[model samples]
Target: MNIISENKSKKIEIEENKSKILDIKKEIEEKKIKIEDKKKELSKVKDMAKGEKEKMEEYKELKKQFKKIENEIYSTIAPLKREMRKLEKIVTDKKLKKQIQEYIEFPVKTFLNDSDLNVFRESIPNIEKIEKNPRKREKILRLIEYVLDGNLEDKKKEYMAYKEKVDSFVITSREENKEGIIKRKIDNLQSEIIKSEEKIKNLETKNDLLQKEILKSEEDIIEILEKDLDVKVQE
Candidate 1:
């Protein structure tokens, strides 16, 4: 009876172990699927990036599409990570944490999930302590706010600087374009002047020919008159 009871207990323990293993496997598969989905989302973003054009109409449309896909990827990954954290919390398995670390510490798109995840994981031990300590939370929150506000201010300045530089570049380009147009106009005017000079030369030649013909006709009339006079004298 003792032997049978021992065997039954071992079997139950094995079954429990199997169940836990299956659960872990399922979770891992789900994570892999999510990773695959993220890869696909990245691919779509790349495709959208390739679709840009120099024309404002096509470029604006592509820009909008790219922004949409980028936002979707970011939003999906953030929530997926939060979900993963919740799942990790439920599993008591140590290997599960390692897997979570593997996924989170990866060079993914999220700031929270990248190199920072390990830091967050390290802070997991202090989570309960920090929660219990209100002052700690307040301190952390203040620090975060300060950092974020400073970053935003820096970004604003940088953006303004960039905008100014771009505006200057545009103005310079416009000036160059204007100069090019003026140069073309000047060249065209010079060509027109040459054509006009040629036309004037042609008109002068025509005038000289007309004048010579008139002189020749006058001489011929005078000769005819002299011949008539000579014939009368002879008679």
Candidate 2:
């Protein structure tokens, strides 16, 4: 009876060991599955971080371009602004003053061109009707003089002899303000410079946001590496 009991006990002990071994294998499989899931998560985080890094580089390049454009614009327009200020000091007519201010503000190439001259010439008849009123007459005459002065300078290079003589009267009567002609060109450049500066400011704001996004992405990547991978990030 003792010998039979010993054989049964040995059989039971062997079965218990087999069960423990199976349990350990199942636990190892579960851990392996968890590790694989974490690896996938870590890979996704790295991809996100890489995308953010690329965006940061792109933003930096864009910022450089914006800065370059801004500098070029300032260099081109600064001299023109100074010239406009100098011209402003010499002109006394309120109409001309307003025109100068408009030129500086708008700065378009086609402004105050031949078409504008033709329009002014056509309006002379209407202006003559207002001449009976001294206040209105004087204002109209000043406007005409300013327009004619500008037209004369613009046409001098294209028209000759008799036409030049006829056109010269417009500027000659006004004490020959050559600076007024230059003011028109300065205005156009100033407008371009202003536009470039606005673009730069907008790009600067975008770059700031991109930088913040990159920083956040890097932090997330570090957290994933440390928590999931159980590794320390060097930098």
Candidate 3:
């Protein structure tokens, strides 16, 4: 073929490769959407299962109890952490300042880890000396008193008890119930998702190959324009 005709053919080849890549990408997106739909169907199936559904309700109740205690503890400690952040700026003692830093950074963990408010008790005298705002200092003292009074410790114990009960609870799925009778539905959806994923993978591999072909065609086009026609290609 003449150089001009050869160049035209290479340009067409690049466009064809790009068109094939776009088609493959469209197919991949469709497969992904199908996989998501299958997963949603699977979730609906599990929710319909009578035996597992009742069991999930029990598990949800236990979690509800645990969350109530968890919220109470954090709600009480949240203000303390804010107060500690204020103190962190003005505290003079290195050890007290660092402890306050830890409290501000990880309020729940530090508060639970410190037994009997030992760090606060040790720094109380220092805090009183440096705190300039009477209202803030009073609020800090009251919060410290709350921590030392064993109320938080009692709640902590309760939290741990509920936590263990929640964690130790088990969830098992059975296929024999009236709702669970269509376990095959779940199996079929899972199979569909797997097949859709495999198709996407194959499409991706094909697209990558097409990309290499497009690059080769473009390179050939550039060479023909620059060398055969003695043309100045912009790119």
lDDT of 1 by residue, 121-225 (tens): 433454444344677656544533443444334433443454455555456546655435545554554555455455555645555554555455455556655
Number of clashes recorded per candidate: 0, 2, 0
lDDT (Cα, tens digit) per residue for candidate 3, span 1-235: 9788998899898998899999999999999999998899888887776555686687789789888987887877777665566666766679778878877777776776776565567546656654668998887778777877777888788878887777766423333344346577777888899999999999999999999999999888888777855544433
CA deviation > 4 Å runs, candidate 2: 1-13, 84-235
- Give Cα distance to truth, residue 206, candidate 2, Å: 56
Instruction: Specify the highest-lDDT model's number.
Output: 3
Residue 115 lDDT in candidate 1: 31
Task: Report the C-alpha lDDT of model 2 over 80-107, residue by residue, as the tens digit.
Answer: 3333444455556676556555545643
How many clashes would you count in candidate 1?
0
User: What lDDT does model 1 reach?
Assistant: 0.49
- Is candidate 1 or 2 superior in TM-score? 2
TM-score order, best first, reads 3, 2, 1
Point out the worst 10-residue segment of candidate 1 by lDDT: 107-116
Please provide TM-scores, in order, for all candidate models, with all chains considered together.
Answer: 0.31, 0.34, 0.46
Residue 30 in candidate 3, Cα distance off native in Å: 42
